[model samples]
Target: MARHSFQSAMATQAGNGHVLGYTVWNHFFRPETDELHPMGITQLNRLVRRSWREPLQLYVETAHDLRFDPGAPADYAKDRDELDARRMQAISTYLSVVANRNDVNLFVHDPPRAGMSSDEAWRGDKDMVHGAPRGYLTAEAIAKGAISSEAPGGFPITLQPDLGGAGMAFPQPPNFGGDIPVGDFGGDFGGEFDVPPGF
Candidate 1:
């Protein structure tokens, strides 16, 4: 079955003089088997409603490729650009809804550092497009003693532990070292380090 009625909706909206544009790059169309589930519109809605947080992580990790034909006319290129912008705006809106509902922070990934341009940074990793929330879902967080839901407010009411340290730390290097000795150190050089005498 088709994933979403996005194209038809876009057509109707455009007919009504809306600024929205339509294109296949939006990934809202139906997919064949072996394709990613929940194409575009459904994916956004599912991310908002998912009880598990890992799927959200996966969604951010998945790449969204936007390509254009090299020989397309200038007018077609302009339309495609506009459509792409609208699609991205829609995705951002969905993310905002999910973050607000869950009472979690949402932010764009950090800007590129030295030796990396902004475009390269974005294209390098799909996860780099958005920052992940620090803690798991409210229930998971509460069970882990990371937070409390009994505060005066709703859903994500209280913080039993600070959010800053909730996320997993980056991987550390394994502890290991070579036992080989260097020349002039402790062990003999096996006479392989013979050097000519200097005047």
Candidate 2:
């Protein structure tokens, strides 16, 4: 269900012709299967291929150690770290092979223990993940850096065309001819515009 929902939204986003780019945190792992879910690797592939010629920028983030399952106890810290490592490896592989392009940017963040001599580095507000306020600030810094620097081969970051002088030029819908099919999309999800969890 999750995979299908993701696919439908991705198709809509690419076809909408206004969205240029977005960021994704590496937290789509399924503990039971111990693999990065198809949301990023598979569904994203579909979008990238469909819009291969479009100017779409994707920023893939490394696993942030601060986020965790709130129910898990502190004793699971080591296990979570190991999982993050594995998730990073999988993300790296996908970036190198599938999403390797000037449009796709990968940012590597420092681990929670990078500059800390003790657990104080992870300290933050109660009921929050590690590094609470400060750790998130570090993430924001990295993201800003990635966006500020020029991408290899230098693709200009244009969210939308100029609208002040003339009316905004929305992309024309693809001419799919008159053919239409009635059936499942060969996936669980059916609609193309169902909103995902977060906007």
Candidate 3:
């Protein structure tokens, strides 16, 4: 679905036992729409049929640029960090829905411990991507995820072959940028699923 579609899902699910909204760093491999990433809520809502409430989850990317506010024409909620705790509070909302303990994933790529190489990465250390400032899904927050993993320091990233998990599974945590293949540039990517009864 698109931005409108996503918001419709959230607003409908809001206060209904599902999640209200999610905190974010405003970055990701957003499927290009008009040569740009579509709306987050819209994207999430579109995948409602494949959603799993038992572990109904969403990813929150963070980086330094997450400190800024989003522009107008908001499809759903606003991406603004007018205050400090509110930022964290936004994330807290996601936790509330899942009823989990701060299940936040910090997708960052700093020098010492960065998960991104393209300075213009959506969640890079401090770069502008698609007219939006880089976000902060801090490494410190990964542990908060339902299942957090990391590629230790200095492990060159490599997009060996995760072909949507056809038959290959990563042995270790995923580093930001290895000499791998696929993805925006070239890194380990893709998450697959089993085919249903019939395609």
Candidate 4:
């Protein structure tokens, strides 16, 4: 069924005590259109029929980037890896919380296995190589004082780059020509300094 209409029906059910609330799965997208329309009666009826047995549930898509581009930089690769790691950790933490509370059911499709094309990978055929949605859940936990650290499995968690100044640094490549004169490198790198013997 078209997602909007399904959502509307779910809302109606919630209002009438047919259900408490519903969860939405998959990416949210709206086609470019001036007016929104509801799903067909057949689809709505099918959904309502299933609602009798199906609990309110939502699906969380794997938040991983699957496409590979050969031209990406080394820095980008490193940053992407770090970001994915953090994301997965967050998801783990969130799952842990949900399990503890037993209040809501969260559904996630298994990621595809390794070595698959992006299109095939989207079918849950292979695991993701990058871009997992883990960190946000951990971040929310931390903000709510639910978790002391962002680490999953009870391991020590280091500061993530987004957390503050962690992993931040000024690029200081080796001065192959030796240190340039302070006058030559003015502004931020400027100031009075003793000249080297050679200079």
Per-residue lDDT for 174 in model 4? 19
Estimate, for each residue in 35-95, the C-alpha lDDT of model 3 and write its tens digit.
1134543544343334434444543433333333345434212332222234344444534
What TM-score does candidate 1 reach?
0.23
| Per-residue lDDT of 13 in model 4 | 60
Q: lDDT tens string, model 2, 138-198? A: 3434445533322222322211222232211111112233244312334222212222222
Q: Candidate 4 overall Cα lDDT vs. reference? A: 0.37
For each candidate, give its TM-score against the true structure.
Answer: 0.23, 0.27, 0.21, 0.19
- Tens-place lDDT per residue, model 4, 48-158, is 345545442433333344344578766555654554444434433443464332233445443333246788658563233212223323454546665343233322233
- Deviating ranges (above 4 Å) for candidate 2: 1-27, 32-34, 46-72, 100-199
Alpha-carbon lDDT, every model: 0.37, 0.44, 0.35, 0.37
Q: If ranked by TM-score, best first, what sequence of candidates would result? A: 2, 1, 3, 4
Clashing pairs in 1: none
Question: Which sections of candidate 1 miss by over 4 Å?
Answer: 1-39, 48-72, 98-199
Error of 3 at 142 (Å): 58
Q: In candidate 1, how many Å is residue 7 off?
A: 40
